[model samples]
Target: MTATLQPVLSADAMVRDAAGRAFDDLAADWFRSEATFPDDAARVRKRQALLNAVAALGFADALASPDAREAWVDAASILRAQARSAAPIDMALLLATGDRLASIAGDPSLYECAADAGLPGNAQAVLALALGRCLQICAALEAALDLSLQYVQDRRQFGRPLARFQAIQHSLAIAAEELAASTALTDLALACMVREGCASARLPGLLDAAALVLGHAIDVVYDASHQAHGAIGFTREYPLHRHSLNLLRWRDDLQRLRGGELRCAERLGDAALQAQGVWSAVTALMQPGDRHD
Candidate 1:
């Protein structure tokens, strides 16, 4: 046999694949159902179990990966998969070390670690945590959309499926558009982080824009999904409520984080004005070497 060379996967690809497999195992073993716990104690037990399972899956090793960018990519993948399950787990805190520094009284998801100037690399770690949370939100929105799409396609009214209606299509289309825009903004922010490190001066602006877009997306996705499923969506038996509730909680946490949503909007507006336009401002924020005047 002639000597044959097998292609070697890059480190990033290997990391992503390992994270995906770990999540798949978790979903199969732990998140097989969307059933609710009987009480707070039960819920706490399940949460603790989830943390143990995640730890067993070697996520900590992935988090400590040498390549910072690959480590984030792996974390994002794991968080996204966990969100899609609609399981009540604080994967963010488990995967994102900086989230442990959350100074918020009630909301652990809202981070304040980035502001601690005395801590080395705290800014980058906080930024990574925020980005990972964004991925989770996006994944939850995607699950809701997927459920709504399936419901409409199967539901019949009069003589045809609800999906045949233009109004339903329009609503779903708007939801998808919002989701896509939010995801794209987050991806752009992640790209900026990969190119310029999460501590880059340009990162905060991109993150602000991503957060602004994601806030709007959560609203649109929630309305459209519930509207599509009608009363059933609100029922505890239906799984849609799980993702919806998660989205709403995350939205509130983001709004309350740091200086709040209004401050983020104000900062973005100020940056736009400084750059003379919104498009130019966002474009400059994505550039690794751009020295904005």
Candidate 2:
């Protein structure tokens, strides 16, 4: 038998393409109808299938790699794609962070003994959780924005389209800005995590950054989306409610998982103080080539 060589793709491109195709296929197979929502058995089976597909693509192993930067970037791509889908599966939490948790679960004592031992992995998990939630929230907010735009354009009041009203347009514009800002922050956090690596001493700073971005993004996006969507957004029949509820629920879960933003901020502050100054602490993690000025 002759051996065949497989072609390799860039990590980011490979993850982005595979994740998109997988999620699209999953949505087609499972999320096509409202019946999928109420059926617990179907949802679980579909979600499991989705996870298996992602694992087959090597996403789970990438997240556990010793090369933290590459792992974080790959995980982020997978998470963003999962978030873009209308499917109810929390693949980001389950596939990305869950894999890491399982890896360390065999030895609880090791984690409990050293104060600084599990900090790196915990920080990574926390950041992953935040990234996943941010992507999910962004997806929901964008969907809400689309729905609002379509509604205002089609809905008429007093012989004119609702979109013709300056108030409605202004509200939507504000919502769009919030979404853009949130997405930008999420991107920035991901970039930092990939650049510095999870085991870097600046991991706490990265956690602090993720905490701030996720916290503020969720708040702004939630309020703006709900306001733009109005009464119908809360209704179960409307697709907006699913995204909104998920965002609301995940935000709470993320906060509790990481001890909230205040604690994160305080930890960063302490680290800065210990290093004598915040700027010095930040620069300490910088490589010789990283400093431009």
Clash counts for all predictions: 0, 0
Location of the lowest summed lDDT over 10 successive residues in candidate 2: 106-115
Clashing residue pairs found in predicted model 2? none
- TM-score, every prediction: 0.71, 0.62
Q: lDDT values of the candidates?
A: 0.65, 0.55
Best by TM-score: 1
lDDT by residue (tens digit), candidate 2, 1-293: 23565322133657776866765665565444434455444344344433333332234234534554556555665656665555553433444444554222211111222123243254555455555555556666676677778878877877998889888788778778877876665665555556554444454455465566666766766676666566877665677665665555555544544576788778777877998998876666333224111
**Candidate 1 lDDT, 169-263, residue by residue in tens:** 99999999999998787776656655555556877777777678899999999999999999999776888877887787566544544246888
RMSD of 1: 9.2
Runs of candidate 2 exceeding 4 Å displacement = 1-17, 23-61, 64-68, 71-74, 88-123, 268-293
How does residue 246 of candidate 1 score in lDDT? 73
Top model number, lDDT: 1
